[model samples]
Target: MTSPLSVIILAAGKGTRMQSAKPKVLQTLAGKSLLAHVLDTCNQLTVDETIIVHGFGGDQVKSEITNQYTQSSFTWVAQTEQLGTGHAVKVTLSDLPKSGKSLILYGDVPLVSCQTLAALKAANTDGMSMLTLTVDNPFGLGRIKRDQNGNIEAIVEQKDASADEQNIREINSGIYCVDNALLHKYLPELSNNNAQQEYYLTDIVKMAVADGITIVAIEPEHTFEIEGVNNRQQLASLERTWQRKVVADLQEAGVQFADPTRVDIRGSLSAGQDVFIDVNVVFEGDCTLGDNVYIEAGCVIKNAQIGNACYIKPYCVIDRADIGAGVDIGPFAHLRPDTVLSDNSKVGNFVEIKKSTIGQGSKVNHLSYIGDATVGTGVNVGAGVITCNYDGVNKSQTIIGDNAFIGSNASLVAPVTIGDTATIAAGSVITKDVDSSALAFGRARQVQKNDFQRPTKK
Candidate 1:
């Protein structure tokens, strides 16, 4: 509830271990780029100002973010060189005001909680508050050097630590909440005096301690919250960690998971009570599930909302779709953009619905493509039925009234309609609208051939 804070995320690493053409920060975990996760976390913290310091693939990173978050209040900072972590922050932090403190994070470590960050902000005072934790082996990490009273004195890197310091468990997590005014005052004085010729942010702790400024070291709520992703293996490990954590959270919220490990939720997923999610479900973008919704395994839903009691079967891809209550979708269905199904409607296996609106209790079952159509209630669309929505020139629509029955192998060429209770016979191609209770069969009647003669072979 304090004033919105500033945030700077370092995302400059090339991530050579990933062996990928794309930058590490641009690698996707749970369907979003790694840096997007960090930016989203910052937004969740109500950070007034956020900056992304990009080094490797900086242009692509900036373009992707700009395309995705057109209205977000964030500044993109470019770091041309692959400098140390301290130099990465220093170069891009110019956009921030010199007066307010900031919460710094790494783009590769995206699962940090805002609650922990808020606690760090609460501990931020005259100097800085670092997100610290004790590990079993702090050999390569900078040890947290404290005074007799247990106050953080200085941080010593692995090579700089003495024999006694090697046994110390508490270490720097590389995440901090520092006083911006003080940081700005001493930033220019930072020198590349280390063996690697890289500036050290840890030096600020010594400066603050010598000047009698307070430095607080708060432990992270979860140890994995600060874990960094260096390769595909690590990225995948963290992705699973984040997904499993979300599954656990949802399980606590009364969501029944068929197989927790197989589900992947990329963006925000809000579920009502009694929602059931099956295995291998990848939910991207934003999705909302109403009460009693049953999602079967291998369902990929995105930018879609499922109504109460809707059953989404296996291998269903619902994107940019909206389903009403009691709807049943697919064992193999693709509900594309602008598709909407009313209550009690059914789209069975091998069915694809695009830019169509199916009315209540309608059925489009098996081997069908219903695009650019408006179907009324109680419509029975048999197997292998298709609405020929696309002509050589432009797309068209097929309108069917209530209780209309379209038989198997029927192709209803659009800009066409069928009146209420009209029946189209099997293998019919409907090119014009039919009247109520009429039987429309556009195909020619059967003609028998007799006495067929065989021709001589060439």
Candidate 2:
């Protein structure tokens, strides 16, 4: 049977190096706070309880978690004094139970895999487990020591380590899985006699060793999985590292990127077979693209869906829009919230669509604003057309039936309807309904004054 599990995330550090007023864990990567990412990973484990130890900017940290991640449940413990990592966990002792295991994680180290964590938890069958890493340069990190028989010994921090200990390549990753009871037993024994004059969490290893408790050390599969962020430079570096992994996975899945380094996915993005994304394209929020979809350069798509065989041209911004299969969207189109384009439709350059549905095979070619409208199949909307959907006080709708042809520079005023096969003249402002196969013209009569003269500048 699996052991009951709890999580304690350490996020109390002030991160003086980051030079930001907000807490360090609140720093975002791929549009999610670092703490939020850790919480997301912990939620996958379905642990019995999750506790966060926050100190500096504690209230803002709690607020960020509460406002953004509504699904996550955590007991917040404020570390009143910024003592150390050991003290951070010490403050949460009351919230943890006596029997179940507790997994210690870092908020700034956000990319640790669920598989590695599960394995670490499983490794703690009887005693404590420590997550270690083997890096070429372990200069600033804590070093892991072992005895002659290869049994686990203890961890030595950089300042506390001797010259020989500092040469060891294997360093502590600062993540641990310990029995809750053992943690409670050993936490109070931690002393603040180190170089930094703070209670180091690594000291617990020596206490466990002296007490004859088994210490299990496990190394993560990848070095980047254990990387932490402290400053702006490191944050940007990790961001690229994460993007590289994301793009590589997509490449393995047969999605081709024009330049993998240039693409940014702030939230979730999934593409089907043969989907091709061009340079400088950003996919934010939840977006899915179907098979044979082609996204051109400089496009930003947020909370949208692009259907199969669709072609999206350069520099378009689509937000909260649903585009259907075999559709064509622009070099400079702006699709706002509540916009839907049916199969084979075209929303061309310089067109802005909002709260409207363009039906199957319909075409709104260029320089148009279609908002709060529903347009039928096979309708042709020419350049410089406007739906005139909004007034100062209220907004209304414009409806166009199948096979209707709206001329260039036409303004279809709100609450108007054009029936099937109707024709609207260029530059007309139609305010009433036009029947099927009928012609409508709402422009002023053509009258030329013989003696018209330009006014002189005053």
Candidate 2 ranges beyond 4 A from true positions: 451-458
How does each model score on TM-score? 0.95, 0.96
- Could you give me the TM-score of model 1 versus the true structure? 0.95
Score each candidate by Cα lDDT: 0.88, 0.92
Best by TM-score: 2
List model 2 lDDT by residue over 1-458, tens digit each. Answer: 76789999999988899999999999999978998888888877869999999989999999988988787678999999978889999999999998889999999999898988998998886679988988889999999998998777889989989999999999899999999998889898889998999989888888888988888888888777789999999999999998998899899988999999999998888889999999999988999999999999999999999999999999999999999999999989999999999999999999999999999999999999999999999999999999998788899999999999999999998989999999999999999999999999999899999888989999
lDDT of 2: 0.92
As a whole number from 0 to 100, the lDDT of residue 75 in candidate 2 is 95
1-458 in candidate 1: lDDT tens per residue?
A: 36547898988889999998898888998889988888877777767788888888888888888898988966888888865777887886568787778888998988788888889988987668998889998778989999999888998888878899989999898899987876786667777887768888888888889889889888877888988899888888888888888899899999999888889999889899999988889999999999999999898899998899998889999999999999999998999999999999999999999999999999999999999999999999999999999998999989999999999999999999899999999999989889989998978889988997889799
